[model samples]
Target: METDLLIIGGGPAGLHAALTADRAGARVVVADESFSLGGQLRQQTQWLSNLPGQYGYGKKRGTWVNEQLINQVGASNVQVLKKHTMIGSYLNGNIGVSDGDKTFEIQSRKNIIAPGAQEEAKVFPGWTLPGVMTAGAAQILINREKVLPGKRAVMVGSNDFSLEVARQLNSCGITVEAIVEEKNQIICSDGELVKTLENVPVYTNSTIEIVTGAGEVEHVVIQTPDGLKEVNVDLVCIANGFSPILEPFEIMNCHFVYQKELGGWLAAYNIHLQTTNPSCYIAGNAAGITDFGSILLTGEIAALSALEAMGFISSAEGTEQKSRCWRELANLESEKVLQARTEMLADYHQKHELDLPDYFMKIKGGKMYG
Candidate 1:
């Protein structure tokens, strides 16, 4: 398949980018691992806010927004290839993708990679148990497959995402015995704290010492200041946090820095979202962890940036979009789970000798070795 643009991940970022580029009269090809599109949007179950100018501000369920994007993709000149996994880098401006039985060579002038994120599984004793899984897996079971993970569950993590997953599990009629966190106290607002407290008790200053089970998870041991508490649970959802899908960026040889707030290692993109390789651009959470609105706007802005780089869109038009997108991005970073630690970012600028914008100067983690 030959096209002007090839979006390597059909989630929120990829789909949004594909739609915008196609609307600009560029032929787009969107490939995803799932049978349909929408990436992590499929796992979400809340209302989105503070979107870009094109999206506007609206309160809509994750399902609704995801469906809407799929419809938009269908209506545009974007070709959707479901169940296709990108196997290799864009060598000579072309990429190799496989759909189970066959491999296809897609040649494109530009590429937008939005592979999304995956939950990080913290290694502990018995974490490899059958019933031990990431919160995302449980989300897929309940949100997508409509299957309850287990009758009794010991949820780990106390962030907004983990709490939301607990609520989703409760909605599915599963018994969430307890919500555990490594921190001493919940970090959410009082209102959210009150609501969650009413449903499940939060065991703060605790960590899952070990997950013990025979063939599956039978119980979990929580290490606390006082002592160890054993909770009998059939399933354990390790919702510690997520990490960006960085394999593709690494394969493309992009320079990276470990930003814990952004969910570990992320590609270093300029204000224009272009990576170290001028031909490649990073978008969405893959750039760093932000809100849903940031994801949409970043994806759209990336499309514009790529278009301008390819001479399909004007630099002036792209600049206007960038200004708006940056505001939304700032709003997201300033008020979300982990705000940017501006001081920690001095290393990147000093070392790389690049004049990065404030939006790209967020560094909230430690140094990563390979």
Candidate 2:
């Protein structure tokens, strides 16, 4: 397959990129590993609204915006390769895509990498047990698959996502044993979240020491200043932060920076979303772990940049559009950085530094847990 613009993800970012480029009179193809579109928004319990005059405000204002954006992408006549996993990219702008058994090579004049990020689970004893899962995974199961891992659950994290997921689980009649944070504070600045946490039993300065069960999770041992305590729980949801999925672009030697504020390593890009290699662009969580609204804006910027670079759009128009987009990106980046600093200060938890339980070495060899 060949396209003027090849988008390597189907999430909000990639979908928006495809739509933008297609609207700019460029042939676009979107390849996504997921069965459908919408990305993480599909798993969220409620929509988050951005403040007025905000850069990404209108992009992700409400539930209607998400639905409308996705519908627009689907209706744009964009060629979507659903369930296609892009395994690799070459220097000459060729992408390797696979769908389980078969593989296809897609050559593009310009390529956009928006593979997104993956949730990182800080290893603890019995973490690999059948009943234990990431908060994101649990949400997917409960929201999409209509299956609950267990009745009683322990959620470990202090982010807004963690709290929202806990609320969702509790609403579904799941017994939430407790929401534990290794720190003493809730890491969200949202006033609504703070009020919501008051209703749930929240344990501060605590970490899950061990999870014990015969073949599944039956109990979770937590370590706190008081002492070690055991709580009966059928499920444990690890809500550690996410890490960028940059392996595909890394193979292409794309330049990246380790930004602790952005949840670890992120591919480096300029205001135009051009990566180290000019022919290859990146956006969304694949570029960095920011909000969905920012990712969508970046995707649009990246598509416009790619279209301009490919001679599909005049330089004058591209420059004017890019200037407006860059201002918006800068504003969004500022807001995110502010929130990130607040969360970091509030949580006082270091990234990728959580102590792993001794049990992880027993089952999975001596490999270090992420």
Q: Cα RMSD to native, each candidate?
A: 4.7, 10.6
Best by TM-score: 1
| Stretches of candidate 2 exceeding 4 Å from the true structure | 51-64, 90-93, 332-370
RMSD of 1: 4.7
Model 1, span 228-264: residue lDDT tens: 8888999998887777788877777778877677777
C-alpha positional error of residue 140 in candidate 2 after TM-score superposition, expressed in Å = 0.4
TM-score of each: 0.90, 0.85
Candidate 1 local Cα displacement, residue 184, angstroms: 1.0
Q: Give, for candidate 1, the lowest lDDT window spanning 10 residues.
A: 361-370
